[model samples]
Target chain A: GDKVKQSPSALSLQEGTNSALRCNFSIAATTVQWFLQNPRGSLMNLFYLVPGTKENGRLKSAFDSKESYSTLHIRDAQLEDSGTYFCAAEAPGGSAKLIFGEGTKLTVSS
Target chain B: EAAVTQSPRNKVTVTGGNVTLSCRQTNSHNYMYWYRQDTGHGLRLIHYSYGAGNLQIGDVPDGYKATRTTQEDFFLLLELASPSQTSLYFCASSDRDTQYFGPGTRLLVL
Candidate 1:
């Protein structure tokens, strides 16, 4: 059984459209982080949440510890947003270790 | 933004060979982690440390050794490389709240 499960293994979106990626945790997650792996293989942290919502630029993320899930929303997608998005959850008893989902590969077309 | 850097951005080794991946963070974070990413697994934690001279086992700690010698440096060692160990490795640092990742190191074992 997977500790973290992601939805929509892949997604394709048009530029200026909106889409959301999700992660469900079977563990008692205390926090969640979202990362975007670019085409060049660089993984960048996009959001770190603690059971709440955060918005930066056109990206918004929410983590619900009680519900054991997290979501990352991208608004007005751009061509540069074509990449793989991963959500990682930190369990309550872990030593700062994160369990990651399989990731959602996103392709934004012009 | 936190700055995390990895050395030998790419690596190649043969079976039973030895290799090491280096990571450094300038953010003065207390926790550091090493993770390996595969095609379907996304990312799995290999090891983590709370501070220098401290090590903690992660979910997938087998076949991997990690050491934290200083607050700014963490290293992952592969004493007996195998083809199954070929994947992208990532290093991350966290202030106990948010984690930032470094540029990944791609390893190929023949």
Candidate 2:
């Protein structure tokens, strides 16, 4: 079984719409980070959360260490938002490496 | 600008061949990591380093070895390459709690 399980493995939305992605962890994570892998296969950092919430432009993310879960909300989705969204969790005891989920492939259609 | 660079941009090798993927970071971060991305599985860490001359095993380190020769240079080596090792590789450097990723290296094993 995967320590970090992402829900809605694949999602589709229309431009200007909105959607949310979630990650459930069983690793007793201490921190969480979200990234968007664009079409060019480049991973871009979206949010770094430590048991709290953060907002950037139309993207917002929240992480709950105690609950071992995190969420990413995308508003006013654009075509450029179409990519694979990945969530990684940092456990307390390891060498401070990240455990990533399988990821959610998001497709934004115009 | 903060950046992580990897090379070669693309590679192809036969089974039992040797391959080395290189990474460089200009952010002057203390932590560096190597990861591979596949279709279903997003990204899995292969190796990491706290600083120069330090190496740490990641979740999926088998068949892979890594060395951090300098603060800005980290290298991943495949002693005996196999078809299963073909995938996109990414290097990352983390400062504070945020991680910056490289453009990625695409490897094909035959």
Candidate 3:
């Protein structure tokens, strides 16, 4: 039983297309964070949510604690967006440790 | 401009050898974490510390030891490396919110 499950293990998109990645948490998650791991393996934090939604640039993220799920949306994808996207959640009963999903590898082509 | 830097971006060692991965954060964050990324498992926490001289065990603590000597530095030590230990190690710093990650270190145990 995975505490955190991610959808669409992999994705391929056109440069200007849009896509959404999701994560479902079986545990009672209080906080959720999204990250992008580039091809060189550097991880960049995209958003940290405590319920509700947040947007930056062309990316938007939403976390619903009651639903135990989170979503990351990319509008107008770019070549730089081609990477593995991961969502991690911190459970209310856990020891402040984060449980990460298996990640969604995204490939953007021109 | 918070930065979390990991040393020895890449390393190769023989089995039974000892390896030390170093992490330093200039953000003066209170929490520091060590994680390993495998093929299927996106990122698994190995160890973490709230501050200097305070160490906490993570989900996968076996075969790994960690030390937080100062607020700016945290280190992960492997007394006896194995092939299974080969993975991309990431160090992160946080203050109960967004986590800033390092570029990650790729380790190969022969």
Model 1, stretches more than 4 Å misplaced? none
**What is candidate 3's lDDT per residue for B34-75, written digit by digit as tens?**
999999988999999999999999999999999999999999
Clashes of each: 0, 0, 0
lDDT per residue (tens digit) for residues A33-82 in model 1: 99899999888889888989999999999999989999999999999999
Residue A49 lDDT in candidate 2: 87
Task: Tell me which of candidates 1 and 3 scores higher on DockQ.
Answer: 3
The residue pairs that clash in candidate 1, if any, are none
What candidate 3 gets wrong by more than 4 Å, as runs, is none
Better of 1 and 3 by lDDT: 3
Interface RMSD value for candidate 1, one decimal?
A: 0.9
State the DockQ of every prediction.
Answer: 0.85, 0.85, 0.87
- Candidate 1: RMSD over Cα atoms? 1.2
Candidate 3: fraction of native contacts reproduced: 0.86
Best by DockQ: 3
Give one digit per residue, the lDDT tens place, for model 2 in A7-26: 89999999999999999999
- State the lDDT at A14 in candidate 2: 96
